[model samples]
Target: MARIAFILLCHKNPDAIIRQAEQLTAAGDCIAVHFDASADAADYNAILNGLQDNPNVTFAKKRVKCGWGEWSLVQATLNAVEAAVEAFPHASHFYMVSGDCMPIKSAGFAHQFLDAHDCDFIESYDFFDSNWIKTGFREERLIYRHFFNERTQKRRFYWGLALQQRLGLRRKIPEDLQIMIGSQWWCLRRRTIEALLDFVQERRDVMRFFQRTWIPDETFFQTLVRHLVPGREIECRTLTFLMFTDYGMPVTFYNDHYDLLLGQDALFARKISVEASQLHERLGGLYASDQMEFEISNEGRTLFQFLTGRGRVGRRFAQRFWEQETTLGRNRELMIIACKKWHVAKRLVAGIRDHTNVPAVEYLFNEEDAALPDLGGIETTLEKRSRHRRALMRMIFDHFESDRLIICLDPSSLDLMSDFFADRATVRLLEISCSFDDDYLAGHARRVGLAGPQTGADTMARLLPTIRHDMVYERDMMRDADFPNMTRISDTGSVDANAHAIAQFLGVSLETGKTLAETPHLFVD
Candidate 1:
């Protein structure tokens, strides 16, 4: 069995910290806590009273007043690690976690996994090579000295930054170390930790340089570990499950996400919501045996896809419709089937799918779930209001095997449709006119209730003009003269006939049993 020493950095929530520490110690793992010196006296006393009986729990003698994006946080961690190393001399590894973090898996499983790897699991990536930092200043965080806390004293932080820029003053980093950055949460071998402590003790200039550096907690250990440990011994990935939003804010978990967290490959989850007592109760004492083979779940992938669709790119695309509509490129093989009534358009899409082998779906921008693969996250009212149509289109195009896609358009989405097809030079738009009776129109009008009562002809007049089409299947004789690219469906009334017409329009022969791959003209020219 691998003896692990957990270094916990706690601030508030005494009960929660007690539970976490007790759970870890219960599993034969020792814990050393560094409660923030700035925290309430009552909370700190409560923690002491709660865990005084546990022999495995130890507290750091030297406490620091920690602040966000400050060197104090890293110093606090170092104090706790030193206390842990001295207390538990048999400890093989040291895992650092925040107060809000909880283990999703059993301690036995973690020990097993760590013993198998035998290397440090910490996310260390090149500071400049990848787009690792999301919101704040990246290279500037190191080169310039930041005296004010960016979160608390925003005005002072900016003023200090401007003053530095005016004076052309820059801090020189230690030549021996390459500045690497990653998640502050990490698990490292005892030897690596000892080497890091020794390196920090010897290098007084490094301490002085990082003391003024911005957010040194993230870069301090990450940069130093690379310098001390060999590249082969470092895994360059954290075992903790940490995810951030587009604004670089951490994602907090609640009670409902129990299954999602349980299914993840990560041993620990960070920054849990304080209100999640039920989540704490469930995962608090839960431990899996070594005999149980853990199968990695798809929940992580699903959650990742969900978060990706709501990320910065998705939000930007969503907001674009308000300022100016973006013209979609016809570089990919895409087809649009528009009808006044969604049911008729859905039926046409069904016929297309039945006859041809091309990928087809109904309502790519429906208010409900999108008919594309893995788009369940785009269903909220804010998501719909943001008008993430282009993002949806991109996902639809990317989901299928090839770049070809056939989508049915709801009449409600005509404005979005028009925006996309405004500069349509290559995309094939097949518009099918549907006849809406008086009853249907009145029901729809009652449901909508804009300014006045609407009739069937009034509805048709409003919806028909926005559709851009290369070909028209005039099912309703009332609008036969409305389209210049008219192909009368009167000649082909049957589903099979209409299917054949669509297949021929797409350059696929139904009689010869040709697939989309065999038809080169549709995709190429």
Candidate 2:
């Protein structure tokens, strides 16, 4: 059996670490905990005490002080790996994960997956064009820290001055030259870990140069691996969750929008704080066994469809159909609105009525006498397009209730809705475009004064009608173009016109199980 190692850097929050460690231990994997020496000894002792029952867990010597944006943390991790290698020489592979990370897949499944891949799974990417400016700042900060070290601060300054004189230089050296980043956590083969350790020990000058660098955690492993095993089978991306943030600081798991992350097929998630209880509960029992058939739920599928560029109309149609046909009725209350368009809102109301058949109250903006609950309203100038849309959406989302469907007529209304609800919000955006086309093609456009000569001309020349006529003519032409084969026409008429047209042209179902009227306007332009 392949062996895996769980290396965690614990400072505070020992409970989370212990819980994770216990889960890993239950799967028959070895656990190694490395506490930062700078952390309180009482905390460390508490962590050790909790792990006393676990036979695989062990403590390492050579404690190091880990500072943010410094090389010390990576050094400490390397030291722990060294210890694990010494103790488990016969082990096949070693996986590195953080205390904050939780496995979405079972250990047996994860082990088998890793065993199949020969490459190291560390995320390494060129930082020059990416959003890695903070990495450069951290590097400069580390240089300053090293230059001003208390004991050798003056000696280092004089040595730098002497070196500058020897090189005939007057100005200070430029610091922000080259920077690269790799994820701090990774899983490596036992031989790979030994190779990295040997490389570090042999290349003292390189290690010393990196020691005074900022955010060395991002570069240390990358530089070593890239030099040692250039062009080897290494995964450029980490199997981790994409973090959501505000002002460069982690905010939440983006759980309110779990659909966004679920589509990515990531192997792990990180920095999920304790408040993401709903996300935790939803993800629980996701991949509990190796033999378990992994299938996304209907809700998961609907969310993925939206994420992959299917607009709100498609999502609502799929969701309503799914709910009626499947056991996903329990989560029907989750509502997500992408934008607030007045017409879209009306369709949303219509869709809700069609699916649930519930008696829903309607309120118009100008209807002062309409009996309705007090929902907040927002006003924005037409000149401020983005702001106007944002404000309208916010107001609509604020008034939205899971039990009651909120219809927004304006696409601009989705702007604010996106902010309040996560990717998982059950709120579906109704396609106003589809409804508009349906109304216009079915002669309702003239009543709304939107149908001009140009509108009628455009619909008459559309592809759906042309294709439908072409198919009919082709069948007749094949049968000698006479009225003798009129029986085939009856058979074709029994076939769903919309379904046949959509299948022949678009290769998808136009009908949503609950049929809408057969109108040319409902077809995509």
lDDT tens readout by residue for model 1, 1-525 = 788899999898898899889888887899999999999989999999999999899999899999999989999999999999999999999999988888888888888889899788887888878667767688789889989999999999999998998999877778888989998889999999999999889999999899989998888999999888899999988888867765667888899777667656788897688899888777776643333455454245434443354212211112354434443445766677666566665655565576667788777565355444555665344355236666566666666755667776654344454455543424565655444444554444344331123223433344333221211222222143243322222122554555455655565776532342233222110
| TM-score against native, each model | 0.68, 0.52
Give the Å shift of residue 525 in candidate 2: 7.7
Candidate 2 accuracy as TM-score: 0.52
Question: What is each predicted model's overall lDDT from 0 to 1?
Answer: 0.70, 0.50
lDDT of 2 by residue, 1-525 (tens): 567876777677777667667766676777677888998888788888999888777666677877775577788888788777776666666666676666655666667777777787776665555665552243243344243332335586446545755776433222432445677767777777889889778877667777765567887776566556554777766766545332455434535644333333455566665666666545433434454333222222222222333122322112222122222123433232221123333443455456443334333222233334443433322333233333333334345443433433233233333332332334332222222233333343333232322333433244234333433333333233221101111111333652343232212244631243233223333
Count clashing residue pairs in model 1: 0
